[model samples]
Target: MSRWSGMPRTTRWVVRVIRPFLQVFTRRDWSGADRLPTGGYVLAPNHLSHLDPFLISHFMVDHGIAPRFLAKDTLMTLPVGGRLLRGTEQIPVYRNTEGAAESLQAAVRAVEAGQVVTIYPEGTLTRDPDAWPMSGRTGAVRVALATGRPLVPMAQWGAQEILWPYSRRLRLLPRKTVRIRIGDPVDLSDLEGRPLTEDLLHEATDRLMDTLTTMLAEVRGELPTRPRLDVRTLEPPRTTYKRLEP
Candidate 1:
């Protein structure tokens, strides 16, 4: 039997406690919820705002799946925040540290045991001027490959409207629709069994990002006129730890 079976009680409780408060912040127009399998799937979605986590976690909780994530090491160290993360069984990505491998391994186990691993592949919020999905890292792909889990691609809109990332502004008035739609499992069958080489992983990552970008296009009703911004090309300090390479 899978160890991660069943919805996480902590998630359900958090969502229940926060749902009413969340409604006070933004409205929701969620779709493709039926697309959410009971478990053992990689939840890949575009990162727009810090609010994405709460919104996505709320989505999972409402739908009966325990919302889990690979959080940053710093978050896992905060007094209260770390306690909650650990209490809920969230994995930690020891970013920029050697421990990053441990986080990837944990994600694989979570998926194999039928748990939801929500990952923001853009790593952080989109530095994309247009907020199109940035070039993705291979961390999510590696976990999928290792555990043979389906990487379910999805796109979200309106969370940024409520609170843009890195901006202290909050425009919570006039409830906004946190539109989210879950798409089909990305087809990585061709690359699954091959040796997990750097080039191969990059190619797989491209396909995964492409699928997510297309979904974002559908959500926005407009395709990005410019190419995706590579966070790696940015300032060295910002590059930090992106994907967990093979």
Candidate 2:
């Protein structure tokens, strides 16, 4: 029996359909699957390409935990997307709406239920121009601190070569290398149980991003020269990829 044995029926069906298509164009070079906990924990990964989610999912399934994501509320509203997300037990965040808290609360529930909850701390694909992970949002930090769970920082590379972020072009003629690695859970013991303040949250959030960025730099074989860009403080660049979903 595999971890995917417990995956929602819809997730299994969808993965079955999608895996063959993806495998034809991509190959995996994943490490640290053994480091993944057999129980609930928060998974924070760098967002490089739109297709990276599925690549991450593939690794999780191979290792026996079904990865669940905080999907956009709009995706939940679509007939097909909604059905698929719901069927696969994906959580939706109603951003900027009164239901935003409910979305986060749902994620906490999922983790308590022994599910591996996935969040892109960057809150969007990196706008680093070089694609180093941008400054992360505070959602991942808040959830981990509230639940007192281990936050696993992960880094991935090579997805961008398959389908570049925002480009419609597909270079599937040659199989692309898809690499991923998971590091030890971040130790936030110092900040746990403290009064939740703006500064504390930012400090905790930066730790996650910094650990992830360091791991990412190792994966890329180069150090990042640019600082993490705060998209909130910056103007939106002209890019076709999705960003900042709640």
lDDT of 1 by residue, 161-238 (tens): 877655556778888888999988888898888888989888888998998888888889998998788866755324
Which candidate ranks first by TM-score, i.e. highest?
A: 2
TM-score of each predicted structure versus truth: 0.90, 0.93
In model 2, pairs of residues that clash are none
User: What do the candidate models score in CA lDDT, each in turn?
Assistant: 0.80, 0.83
Where does model 1 exceed 4 Å of error?
Answer: 1-9, 236-246
Can you write out model 2's per-residue Cα lDDT over 90-140, one digit (the tens) per residue?
Answer: 889887689987988898888877888999898766767677888888888
* Backbone clashes (count) for model 1: 0
